[model samples]
Target: MEGEEGTQNAHLILARKLFLLTHPDVQDIEKVRLREEVFDAVKSDDMAPLYETLAADKIIEMDQSILDSMRAKIGDEIRKLDEKIADAEENLGESEVREAHLAKSLFYIRIGDKDKALEQLKVTESKTVAVGQKMDLVFYTLQIGFFYMDFDLISKSIDKAKNLFEEGGDWERKNRLKVYEGLYCMSTRNFDKAASLFLDSISTFTTYDLFPYDTFVFYTVLTSIISLDRVSLKQKVVDAPEILTVIGKIPCLSEFLNSLYDCQYKSFFSAFAGLTEQIKFDRYLHPHFRYYMREVRTVVYSQFLESYKSVTIDAMAKAFGVTIEFIDLELSRFISAGKLHCKIDKVAGVLETNRPDAKNALYQSTIKQGDFLLNRIQKLSRVIDL
Candidate 1:
């Protein structure tokens, strides 16, 4: 019992020790060796001997004063990891160094220390240079943009990641970037824009059949729809199997559709009206979903709008393969944005066009843009280098 107790005390002592010092040489390589030494000693039952060599009877009975000193030392060691690019650069050889920097950077960010967190990220990027890991660099850069909510920088990073993804970027990372873009729009209360981005993301994977049954894509779609058209999303629940897959992963989301999408339909019709109004009032359209509307309008025309004549909240949701609540949230956003000029008649469970003129303009613009893109694609295809 005495030997076990002694070993346990030695383990604690070593665990609490500040093995990494902030000094240039010490931080660069000495600290790395010291950390390994401490880890190995404790695991191999060799720490007790080291404890005796460092200070006789120190582990057996440490007083308050000793404990206080240990706390201060530990605090000081941690400080070396805080916002220090030099320390990060020096510790490049260690695998755990970046993680340590991440923890320290998060601590600074949580406390509203923006500059400090950025400084740490710069250090992290520099260290990854010699390591030749572009993915780590991209992750750190993207992380900085995310925490700072810097969309311009985030977009730039996405552009850089396009090539990287071809080389080695995983699907999860690529999808995560889309989710981040969706989140950025959502933060601005541009629910239509957010929903469009989310839908485009879903279409990218789904159309290609690249990543079927991807829960993140499903969840993001559900989340974006909930933000813009919860009613339609609730209705879609009955039709789309993907919704069920997501609910299986996140059971709590099922609560959003409790009333069979009562809230979603009302919100959806209202948003649908808002969307048309927005097209006229707010000329800046949602970049992602703009194509979808154009495609549907070009393919169906007045007949397509006619198809939606009996489009109850549930029926519209079924057409889209999303939740009724998600549809409602989206429709609500369109109504708010003045993009969809449809009003919900709760008494009859139907949608009425709010402004026929705005709808005509929306239809015209979408058709023009689609034609423009198609022409651009064709012209590019005819390129012959002679």
Candidate 2:
């Protein structure tokens, strides 16, 4: 779980920079500082192509003089790399040639020239012969995908990595892939799949390039809360040692998880309220913040209603620390949308649970299927006679 530092961390920093760029609360001075930091980072890498691209896009002012200086250094460095590749290839040395190509690939990625970086990685992959090495190359490509938030590239690279693993890969790389794919799924709003993947990697996690172990646990808890049933949440998360170790460190995460599972509605609501700002500020979770809030509310309300055949609106409000009117409106909306299996008694100021009968539902489903089969048999007989 070693953290990335120095120039190797440029891409991740750039990804966060992109998020801060769009933050409404970011001050003008912070924007100026951000620009300077980004410029210093790219310039330190001697990224002529990336600098020119930024200047062309008006992300930064063009300094022709500075561009010329970077281009000179870049040209000299790339030429030496090319020379090494040529020398190695002339001697039919696969490993040296692969190393040279990989050096070039990393230079492009460090310079933020994504298309060229991908092209060079492909060249490096061609020189690579081992399945593990090929999977590593795909990991590099996946890094580029996340750096640019290019979903298509990330998706394709993940598929490629999985296929390479099927051809035989080490356990370490496969575990790392789970983290990458889990993050992608979370960013894309597939919380169910993301939760499963994150839970699977909770103990086996070895990669710190994506995030810290604490942050990883935080994600596992949040996603599992919304996706898993109460029983599974208790079994997998509330009782999981990996989660119990770190959940208390993350703000409100402990209260949020335990309050809901313990049926402490007031505490759950308070904890959930405390977490709203964090969710809103998060780059991945912000997009689905409202949907997540609704789902959490649904889960809590369903859990509360499951224990009561009928409950006074006032008592339910007191239980959840909300107004009677508020609970009435909330239950009405959920019931009308068919999300809750209960109805509100506005006239009597109560909520009446009407849980569906499993056996009856199953019987109806079987009768429908049997009717469909009978019709299909009749049609087949008619066809045969014809």
Candidate 3:
């Protein structure tokens, strides 16, 4: 019993620390006071009212049992807040009423009523409040953005947050907003844009000692590997010591990088397969699985093609552990995209790699160079009246 009690106490202590870390004051005195109250309740194990308060504050990480309990108790909480709102409206200004609405929105979100929460947010936005209150609203909107899976709304909330941070000269929050924006770009398969955003955010995050350093580095390397060519990746990511250090610490990522650099397609796939589900299901990466797979396959095919002038489709399919039809389709895509300079013979079941006609290309290049020289000389002569 003593050991169990000790474990429970440890859990509560950790929870309190997490709560404090996550719930910043944002210059709102009421919020700071409420956070203190929540901490006190946790310390004292006075949980009944604490649960409702946490729910209304959107601070509780809910389980089904907790959700049911909150549902049963939410109406009373809402009623009490509504009464308080009425009293505030009668005696105070719009700011207090806005706070009440924000509180009510948290309860609505806790109960899975997004529509009501959104309505409350609209009301909150319409109210003329202090900068602190407005910043709090931006935080709330970002929460709603994630809950709703609405990218556009998330982008708008980020913009609001960025504006607030800019006015306050909060460089950390501004950089954090860039990280969020980069993640949004990644989810939409804008790899180049996402890579650029992540790279820009890395220095800011690192310099400020931000908590998302691992995440930023991971995505920076991943996006660069996927989106950039080998030469660009070498220059942009692989050569960067800070990013390389992080990659070295993560074994799977390190292996992936090696495989990519070495053109070991099979090893690269193996490393990718060993990645965590969280990495695989990342909001920006999940949708691009098909495209990424094709890209990897193309890399594998290019390497395979370098060893031979021609190869049987069946042989290629078997080597790659895929069906002939799959290989055929992928090859066609590579050919059409000009990624693989090759021709496929359907009847012969062969892919014939084409070597560039260097003589013809050089002849054409020389002709263009001669024509350019003649044109320039003619222009120079005219200028000199020669």
Candidate 4:
């Protein structure tokens, strides 16, 4: 009888502890009074401990009506308790206990523990054989590929995701699967493959069947593909002005493209810096690149002769609006093309200019005459059919 009474006292103490978590600690008496009202419900036997815990969480605090509605359900209270347990685990160190189990490897990723995340995903993949969870399993599989930067695994994961989607899986899951495929191709340095995937993903996301939530992912993936260096992939970087004109069609991607332009400007300035001693005009520009190099050349030459007398990469990036690395890429290209001539003098620091007229004069003479003839022919063609 004495033991039973002790157990009952312990239960009452546990109930009181749970109730205290919901009581607001603010100095405002009215706020405190309002919290007490909720706390009283928590202490009552009418609701379970899960209800009391949910009441303490910020998700519910933002909207009490959700909690009130959820409280009416029986087993859902257990689900709510599970959610609180998940939230509590988030506050622990990067190595979470729950992350090492089941179909929830994403929790480990959220904390940046990629190794542990992969381990959890492998475990989940082994245990789940059900058809309905294939998409979920595929999602975690792609996450594993990204976390470890495993290009081969990324390629295989795309195939797995496609198979899952084709099997009549969830619409939302399929949309995400398409995105993962495109991202995987990009990660593997398969830019051409990724470009097609991104375009297809965009089409799928725009279709009325897809949820609005998927739009952000679609735009981000498209931007990533377009932003890749055309030189790196041996493809032409499309004219920025032309690309910007079409950018508005994707509302989610407009701001991101503006940022890409800012990055391109920074890149152009970096290239200018390396060519200060010898302006190489043709090294980095791809065969199909359409931007006029004359404007960039003019700006760089003026800066080279400016009052600041600081023609270093850092200063050039500031003056021309681009990152230092971008300037470096352009410089290397010019050097390779033999368009820039470099020399050093103490007073001039590093001085650069286009190749001397004597050496390049013959080549320029042919190109200019040929270009002038071609322009005349094109003009005449526009005026007359033949």
Candidate 5:
């Protein structure tokens, strides 16, 4: 009898806390009175009335543990709420019905019925809701996107979020969407676009004092290194004040960036090798690892071509810390792609670089200039005739 009384007192305390926690602002006299009634119902252990009060109040942020307790004590009542959700439209207005669906979804999620939860979410998505409620729905949709690796849905969710927050005067949400969009681009191996987005996000985060500045800067520098030319990197990222501040804070990233900038292939590769597993396993970075590595190799090989007139394949392999066969294959790719004006001597095991013919280069430049002049003249002629 003592234990039973103790349990009842605990329940009463929890019920009161829940009511207090969720009660609307004091200025709202109607909500305050309703919440008092709900508190009374909770005190009387009349959970049916308590649930109705909570749903009418649109209180969906209750702790999962509390909901779990409610489920155990009055599960049939909650299940009945789910069944009645479809019919809610006949009795309640659309907004109230959507609130009921949202509440039902939360309940399903807490009870480990994700499919039902997703089903409820889908229904809620089709209905119109306020901006705040829409934001909540999009957030939950993004979570589902990540869980299932639904890239298409994730992309759509990102677009929806951007549209929702673009003019909503929410700088933080806008910048966050930019970061997620950048991550999606990075995952798709669209390094150029990703680099641009990351730079913009870094600027916003820095200006607004957003958290995760370190992560934003990391990806910005990394994507810039992979996609941007040295001149662009210097102008857009390396010399940017916000990015420089971030680099100053993250020492390893600083070292890596410097190594890449200075064309120190050995140091750059070593720095990358020492990167944390967090970077390696990052959802965005993991998929692009091979592509980024290849870009790094291209950067290294481009530098090598400019530095040496001829280098032995063995020496190149040793410098790059790779096998001769690997070096040969990479060189073959570069040569075939016309990115490197070089030829490999198989017998001599030498990579001979070819400088562009000055006469041919000058001739090509003259032709390009002449074509531009002709196009201008034709445009001027047309203007004169007109």
Candidate 6:
């Protein structure tokens, strides 16, 4: 990631390393691999201060001599960067000064120095004249925000980027920001908004620093499935060329998307089973794994049950490729939890759906709104009388 393309995913690597270091489920052998990776990253980036802190925390046990050597190398690099900045300020144009400051900011980012990276990014932003370069600095700040999972910084940067866009911004950066914001929404569990943003950027995705295109498609399809209705799902996701290309590359996602749409309940259930493991391991999705599972099942069950008012429990069980008793228990739990608008007739081995009628729902909503308007009018009348 430190290649000529200049896309530094150092924070993502660091996050993975930290996750592995502290994860209870990470095997000891994996920890060994992480230690090797940690030192390798530190050496390549010359993260002397970071290395010292990790060593002090007993996360690593590198020798003092290695630390001292790294400190010397890092100090030398900082001096050279400072010299470049000074030279740019003394003799060069604004663009050159911006480049120099950006270099320092990127250096701090590469070395996992969060605070310094942000400070230097602001300095770079100050020197940046155009809206595009200023937005680029925001993107860097956003990278650090993601690296640390700092929601406040992320939210403020998103707002600032939006305001900048209002003044002026490029389409490519605007699209990239959508992906960034979508990822933030995913991390925050705002799946509906994330779904919208991901789908919007599906055709224009180029934010490789945040994640690969395939992973982006994966997020797009997953969020789209849960948030979209059948018509919108078919239009935006099931038929979208961008998603169709990579959806098959991700395990079970293709089946997960198609089977539900095609009313292949058994296949949908099978694909969901496989997807559970993938979601459970994903750092972004892990916390919401069980919740997602329940929601997915609820969606699938509602879809199947919506076809008929009453159906035999045995038939429903067969449709889902599960035992009758299992289907009975699932239906009972979902029914009691109000996730499913259905009831079970245990004696008759039947399941009946009782979804609300749309017209009746609209009528009730209208009545509620009328009451609210009447209340407001009465209050206005009382004020006029006073």
Highest TM-score against the true fold, candidate: 6
Tens digits of per-residue lDDT for model 1, 142-235? 5555444567776776677676666666665576556555655654445566666665565343311111234434434434443433345544
Scanning candidate 3 in windows of ten residues, the lowest lDDT window is: 1-10
In candidate 3, stretches whose alpha carbon ends up further than 4 angstroms from where it belongs are 1-69, 90-98, 128-136, 155-169, 206-216, 248-251, 262-266, 276-284, 299-333, 336-339, 344-386
How many collisions per candidate?
A: 53, 0, 1, 12, 0, 0
Q: Give the TM-scores of the predictions, in the order they appear.
A: 0.39, 0.88, 0.58, 0.32, 0.59, 0.90
TM-score of 5: 0.59
**Against the true structure, candidate 5 has what lDDT?**
0.67
RMSD of each: 17.7, 3.3, 13.4, 21.1, 16.0, 2.8
Error of 1 at 293 (Å): 20
lDDT of each: 0.48, 0.86, 0.65, 0.46, 0.67, 0.86
Greater TM-score among 1 and 4 belongs to 1
lDDT of 2 at 140: 85
Candidate 3 lDDT, tens digit per residue, 1-386? Answer: 00121132222233334334453433366555646665554433324444555567666543457546545576677789799878888988877877777777665644445567678777777774565556656655555555445788888887777777656745555565676677767766777888888877766563221124565677777777767777777777877777876777665887777777776666776787776443544544656767766665666577678878999999888776678998899889889988887999999999999957799879989999999999999999999995
Model 6 worst lDDT window (10 residues): 1-10
Q: Candidate 1 at 262: error in angstroms?
A: 10
lDDT of 3 at 214: 61
- Give the local distance difference test score of model 3: 0.65
